[model samples]
Target: MTSHSAPKLAWTYENRLLLILFMTFGFVFFDRLALSFLFPLMSAELHLTNAQLGMVSSALSLTWALSGAATGAWSDARGTRKPLLIAAVLGFSICSALSGLVAGFVSLIAFRALMGIAEGPVLPLSQSLMVESSTPSRRGMNMGLLQGSAAGLLGAMIGPPVVIGMATAYGWREAFYVSCIPGLLIAFCIWRWVREVPPGGVRHAQAEGAATQAAGGTTVSRWALLKERNILLCVLISCCFLTWFVVIISFAPVFLVENRHLSPSGMGVVMTCLGAAWVLWGFAVPAISDRIGRKPTMIAFALIAAVCPIVLIHGDSVWALGTLVFVTYTGLGCFTLFMATIPAETVRPRAIAGALGLIMGAGELMGGFVAPTVAGFAADKYGLQFAMWMSAVGAILACVLSFALVETAPAVLRRRALACAAARLDTQNVGGR
Candidate 1:
């Protein structure tokens, strides 16, 4: 089996899929982060504590991790992308609308968990779809676009101000109700535009055959995938990355309001910097990896991220803190790299989605689920500043783990292959002479 590259097609199904999935994920982020922005209002009304708030946030992540682990494998076995995505979008949209009707802590947690179950599969499955649709050269950038740039910008940057304004005018509950409308529309669009591609389909059969030969003509077992060093490391590094991520998004607003003496509107303005930074780095860094290599790019980002908490803790002024937040989140753009691009490039195509699920699931379970709960507890017992250090430590550990990663960028792999072939050909010619 010979490996062949897909031609880069502009303004076709590929671009269209990217655009829709990009918007789909943007709505997903909007719905999820809306809860964070509204937490202060909800807490005041419901008499919730810091620990209870953390538990509410963790509830979604708990179900998300559990569902993602199963759904990734299920999608792989089912060999369809569109139906899963459609179901996920509709399920979460309805749940998001229903979130407004919750009466107390139990109901709020339960609804969020249900939303988690619906939304969990969207990340890995959409990533798998994007990879299949794109040319090899564009895989990293497309994944970034879907997971980071557009989604991050819409969800984090625009979502904060928009949701905050809506809450102020209507109510926090109504904001949740309003957020679901876009998701419902995106679900309909996906059902219409998105096509399913099976594993041995006409377009990808050659790529699959080549991958099989590369694996010594054997099918990959789930157990075998778990054993790969890169796969294991990706899961670990993602946990660290998510630790930094979940803590900030879940509690940063609270910290700003309570400890830093910033108003709700001011906090919204500062948090928008995070989204802006994410948009910039998310689009630029992964595309840069297409040329430089994944390992080096990740290492650089992780190192910068490790310092974010320290800078953020010391900055007293709003503009200074906002600038630091931007820098910190700029490093966070590598979320796509750890979660999808690296795992996909390392594994066979058939195993890509499942591998992504493992990476996402494990990270969410530890970093997303547990980290925030612990941070909230720490903030309650120790102080908010102490809680921020937890994220800094996680970022440092992520930087350490990144050093162990294997480079799997397509361009780098191809360059090495070409060099090897050239070396062998030169030896053969010299012997003949």
Candidate 2:
């Protein structure tokens, strides 16, 4: 029998960019999850409490929120994807490696915080990098494949088995060290391959302004972007999305292992199934929704997510929960679509990266920072069920918000482009002698 390859250009610039994004995101998840795996080891060694553990989890988000927007702005002003990509990868990996060496909780938090700072810019910058490279028509498909397939599904699947095996054999610290190595290699790949998008070109407002002024038309300030309505909605959506995402991802595995009494290998298998389903849906659903409309897609997914809690809480066996998780993630895949497509539609071309950074950073703060600690605390006190239940509230809110979201398609962009052109021509005629 002969072997056949998958589509070749599914392995094109779009695919490569998606792969890089996935690797960066996967490393971050692996790094963050290390703390959870290490907690048993670190806590016994240092005599840490639940409260202390919460703080350590919180530390990642605290640093991320503090630096996220600034990093986005820097990317916007500089338009240098490779530098941002390289710095985030190196910083996070180094800090994550150093975390294994920490002797106390305070030092651990500090190192994890540093890791947060390093990793904070990667998500927004990755989105920005993709938006710049792809057209609006394909943006949903591209982002869905990159984030949903590479980062979301692939990372979740790969991280567990690797983390579990390494932690079991060599101890958790060794796992952290092991996980950091892949990122270092990825940093090299990003530096070598990810092209630098030069600053001040066709995408910049100032560049457009200069061209418009030379043609006797008024120039728009980048600052004017702050006044847009959809921008505000994007921020709100990000906050809700992050809150829900964190509520689930941070604690679900812990629930499956501790409360459900599954072995680590069993837990890994279930998660791998769930993760594969999610990545597959992430690739598939967004492509379908792109043809239908983002609004309808979001609403449908949000509603599906709303049902996931019921199945998880009521399920009688591990197979039930595992099956439900897979179904739930199909809906969860909508998140990547929303995150990617909304900004490309809502924000001005020049300000997209910076705007996306602000939204993503804020979302991460809510989702990654606050949600995890709260979920951890709740899981400790009221049981994991409460934490899982709270996710229902978030899914409902996301569904409601989806109903209110703007529909951005090619037609919308064409109309807006035509209007801008007409307004420019009108202004130019008035200024002509």
- Against the true structure, whose TM-score is highest? 1
Q: How accurate is candidate 2 locally (lDDT)?
A: 0.70
lDDT, candidate 1, equals 0.84
Off by over 4 Å in 1: 1-11, 198-221, 418-433
How many clashes (backbone atoms < 3 Å, residues ≥3 apart in a chain or on different chains) does model 2 have?
0
TM-score to native of every candidate shown: 0.91, 0.83
Q: Model 2 over residues 1-433: C-alpha lDDT tens digits? A: 1123222332365557767776777677667666764565466788876556766777787788667777877766655567877988998889988987888878988998998899888877887777766655777887777667765454676666777778888987777776678889989989877755422214454464466668986422335544665566666666777766666665566666667777767777776766677677777777877777778788888777766656666766777777877787665467665666676777666566677667777777776678777877877788888767877777777788778777786655567689999999999999995
Q: Write the per-residue lDDT of candidate 1 for residues 1-433, one digit (tens) a residue.
A: 2223233332267789899999988888888888888988888888877877778778899999989878998777556677989999999999999999988889999999999999999998899888888878788988988898876788899999999999999999999888888988999999888877622335352467566678787445567887998898888998998888888778878888888898899888888888888788887889988999998888888878777767667888889988987877755568888899999888877788889888999999999899989988888999888767888888778888989999999789899999999999999999999
Clashes of 1: 0
After superposition, the stretches of candidate 2 with alpha carbons farther than 4 Å from their true spots are 1-12, 37-51, 198-206, 209-226, 411-433
lDDT of each: 0.84, 0.70
After superposition on all C-alphas, the RMSD of every candidate to the true structure, in Å, is 3.8, 7.4
